[model samples]
Target: MSFTFFTPGPAQLYPTFEKHLQTFVSEQLGSISHRSQQYRDLHKFTVDQLRTLLNVPDSHAILFLGSASEAWERILFSCVELESFHLVNGSFSKKFYDCSNALNKYAHLFEKPMGESFVASEIVVPEYAELICTTHNETSSGVQMPVAEIHKLKQRNPGKFIAVDMVSSAPYPELDYSLIDTAFFSVQKAFGLPAGLGVWIVSEKCLQKAESIRNQYSIGAHNDLPTLWKNALNNETPATPNVMGIYLLGKIAEDFNKIGVQTLRKETEHKASLIYKFIEKQPGFSTFVKEKANRSQTVVVTNTEMPSADIIKHIKAKGMVVGSGYGKYKATQLRIANFPATSVEDVEKLIHELGSL
Candidate 1:
């Protein structure tokens, strides 16, 4: 049976996804050679659509990678020579920090309990840290660090390159590109696309840093920043990329642009409010994150009184699906994605099912 997915990451498909996919297949878009002029046009179209949809600056170059996880390793390897700092509040943020450590970079972290958020004023960035990593929205814990707070960190540490992992909150964070040196997100989350493509947006300054330190560290070979940047200048990639994913992303982004990003954001906020309000009154549930201001508008996590498995099964039977909690909270919590692909009507229906539970 077909079900509307409320799961984070590979959540519900964009409303126009099927139509676009059918057209792409019929047109044989996937068979195009990556090095051909046809492919470069496709590449540029996607990047242009994304820049328009997300308000990305012209100074930033958007490059495609395997996944947001890979971008974590690339950013550390290419940009940092000695030290990096991270604000960790959940699994994903912690994983970015872990990636840095795995890469042999001296990774420093200011960690908070899973459901807590960070305050910019309280963060003490190490002077030796070359790049500062922040997760705009923690998908694992349903906590969001305000974009303003991120801007404050950048302002306070003008010398440090700021990287934001907007993995699950892309096109939603409304970040000021001038403030951040780099940011990334995977297509599966907010873009509502099939998983596989990771979008890394890097500033010219970040590119310069990677070039200066390229010989100093083993910053990879084929997919290194310099290599990626060189090809991206021509609207291409060093290696063959997910052409189908890029096509769908461009089409969907074009759809989003036509609908207007502001309209989508307002709809997302409305839907999030619906779910949070329902959780507030539901007998067997409470929001995982306590502070409303810090709660994520994209991924809403709730502490369930009953096993999350039971709750998930209950909802699945009603023709809908939601995500189980991450890691340790697997059995005790539920995550509901309020991405643009999931409609307000769908959210209302999901709430109705939860209310019935």
Candidate 2:
């Protein structure tokens, strides 16, 4: 009995990436010098792949952070000034808003239910607000925002910086990055790797702003976006880069380049649909997020008629692993990750086990 289903991030890695990682380790990775050419080359490779795969604009500056949360801090401390607008619809979004307040930056929240979409109408575009943050896909709630609508907001408001948390949305398809100032993600969810890496894509406008204010502030160890960008272009990081993670990212990008992002996106959608269909068959189980269109293609969250603790125990005993819901939804909703490596057969097997339970 292999524990085979519904584990969350770090999602299962592709076999090819694992093989490449083994070779990388055996070769003895030297210390990743932040100023070294070899390290810089790895950074450049990653940025180029992201730009090509995600259909990102050439003007956007992609910077690698230690984690997605680091991107949040960097964006808050470096790019955002005065105040910002925070859109909260799930655990992650809510916490992100709180983080902005903790940093002493004023942030207005467009509060909504966990799985609800943030309609552009909710935005007031105040004069003082310089940045706007939203999560592209909420893994905890299994809800995805409409990327098109977000771009529409950007078009309507030219001055504000649009930052998106795309942690759960990457390694699938390219996002619409035209109007976004800072788009960030942790590689663990989409890339199926460990949690040491963060990808930050910045618009040219953001760079201009950072340069304008460069001399006014002291550069922190990891949060200095301007220095990070300069290093990134040379295939380096401001601090020590994640050597093994970057190596894995290079391998993953090569594989993605060969297969294509659109192709991968379709496969991911298929995986989500398969699991949703299986959950549909269960008598007392239903999707946590009510809207069909808003549900995530990467994570599928559902609620069962039984107690969540009991359900978790039963599922685990049956050699399957699933995530408990986040924050208030904990003990009520179950999260199932359907990223690339998750298969249709795996979904069917989990459903059968649940049916037996």
Candidate 3:
């Protein structure tokens, strides 16, 4: 039987995916060389669409890389010369901190328990730390950092750079680009394309940081920030580009643009509310996030009193696929993605099925 995917990131295909694929083959997008004008046009179109749709400023340079995971290394190697600070809460945030350590950078952390968040006023940044990394939404725990709090941290630490992992929450938070120096996400998450492409948006300050360190150490061969900045000036990449992915991203973004980001965000909230409300009223289930304010609109995770396998089994029997909890919580929690690609009708159906159980 066929299944509807509610698994987060690599979750649901954007409703137009099959159509995008047909266009990819019919237009021979895969046959075009990266250096060709056809490929260049595709690159420029995708960049322009993302910038306009996401409200990115002219001061930011948009670059495409492998995955959001790779962007973590790029941010550390390119932007941080010595020390960095992290606000860790869940698996993804902890990974970002681990990435800093893996690179031999002096990484300091102000960690909260799995479901808690950083208090902006209480945050203390180390004097010599060059970058402060934050996860806008932790997909593993379904907890989100408020954008206003991020702005507050920037206000408090004007001299240091703020890097955000918006992996599963981008194009929805309506971030004020002026407040963040760097942000990154992979298409397989919110954008709903097949995996293998990441989008990194960096501001002028971040570019300067990379340029200053370029002469000293090799950040990355094909994806060094300075090289990426230089190529993005012409809407290109240093490596052979993911032409089809870029083309598909452009087409899917165009559809999102036509519908408007505000509308999609509202729809996401509406759909997420249905599930949260269900959990509140249902027995043997509660949100992984203790505070309602900490809940993520894009990825909703619930703690089941019993093993989540029965829920998964019941949902799967109805031809809908749901994700198990991340890492150690695998047997106890369920993760449901509420992305632009997941329809409100589908969410309601899933809620009804979940309620029936």
Candidate 4:
């Protein structure tokens, strides 16, 4: 039997979106100039549609980069001061902090214990830091921070800036931009598009911070804040953007707006719940994160009493591919993704097929 259930970064593309992407490329085939008016119009429409769909405030500035990873570095290199606090709950998050430390920035990590949740109680964020960064949904461990709680923390820490890596979290509802200064995500994951495109939901404060830093220090071409912001506001890029990828992403936002974020959130919750329930019933499997309240709606990480390699091979032979553990958890875990393109039927089919494994 033929099957498909891989849930890594590039999950699956929507059929309708695929057709739209083809038309986009055919129309803009020879368009080499991203600074052209056509490109600017497309870019402006994308940013505007995104802001409307994501409920971003008008008091903010948004940008697009080649990749979300680039956005991470840009936020750190341009906006962050000499020091910042990094909150680590999983491997990818830890890597982000390590990158910050490599830049000679003061990175104080608050790592949570394995199989447990990250509580903000032990994190002592310094008063004079440039920003506080966290991942809203951890792809490595399948844990999601309650952004409502993060917003509450922001309320308490009035002057400190907040940045979020919402790479896999933006498709669902919790994109509460009221408290966050910079929220960045790639288009490939939950956005259901190809890679090489990133969306940045940047706040006015982030722009101000970036501007101040550029004025004080001689910024490099790659990290030029003023040019990046101006180009982004004009719906163009300082460098050539992935025009094809971005055009499709704008259509995705349009589709999401038609259905609404709340509806998508509900759909994701139902799909994730199906898989989680199936895992709970299996003898050799259990969720990586014990607390259901903390489980991610997009990625679900599980622990197997059986050898994880055997489990992975078994599932792959059946045509369903899942993610392995990252960093220290490689041998002990399996991850499943249930994002926007992953339908309820797909979840049910995977659960049934896993039974044969």
Number of the top lDDT candidate:
1
- Deviation of model 1 at 39, angstroms: 0.9
Q: Candidate 4 at residue 209, lDDT?
A: 72
Clashes of each: 0, 3, 0, 0
State TM-scores per candidate. 0.99, 0.92, 0.98, 0.93
The alpha-carbon root-mean-square deviation between model 3 and the true structure, to one decimal in Å, is 1.0
**How well does model 4 score by local distance difference test?**
0.77
For model 1, what is the alpha-carbon lDDT of residue 200? 95
lDDT of 1: 0.92
Candidate 2, 223-263: lDDT as tens digits: 58777777666677666777888778777877787888888
**What stretches of model 4 exceed 4 Å from their correct place?**
1-3, 29-32, 218-220
Which tens-of-lDDT digit does each residue in 1-357 have in candidate 3?
978889897978998999989989998889988887788889999998999889999999889988889999999988898899999999999999999999899999999988787768999999999999999999989999988888899999999999999999988887788888999999998888999999999998888888888787667676888888898887778999788888999998988899998998899899999999999889988988988888999999999987999899999999999999988999999999988877888998998899888
Write out the backbone clash pairs for model 1: none
Worst 10 residues of 2 by lDDT: 214-223
Candidate 1 segments whose C-alpha is farther than 4 A from its true place: none
lDDT of each: 0.92, 0.77, 0.90, 0.77
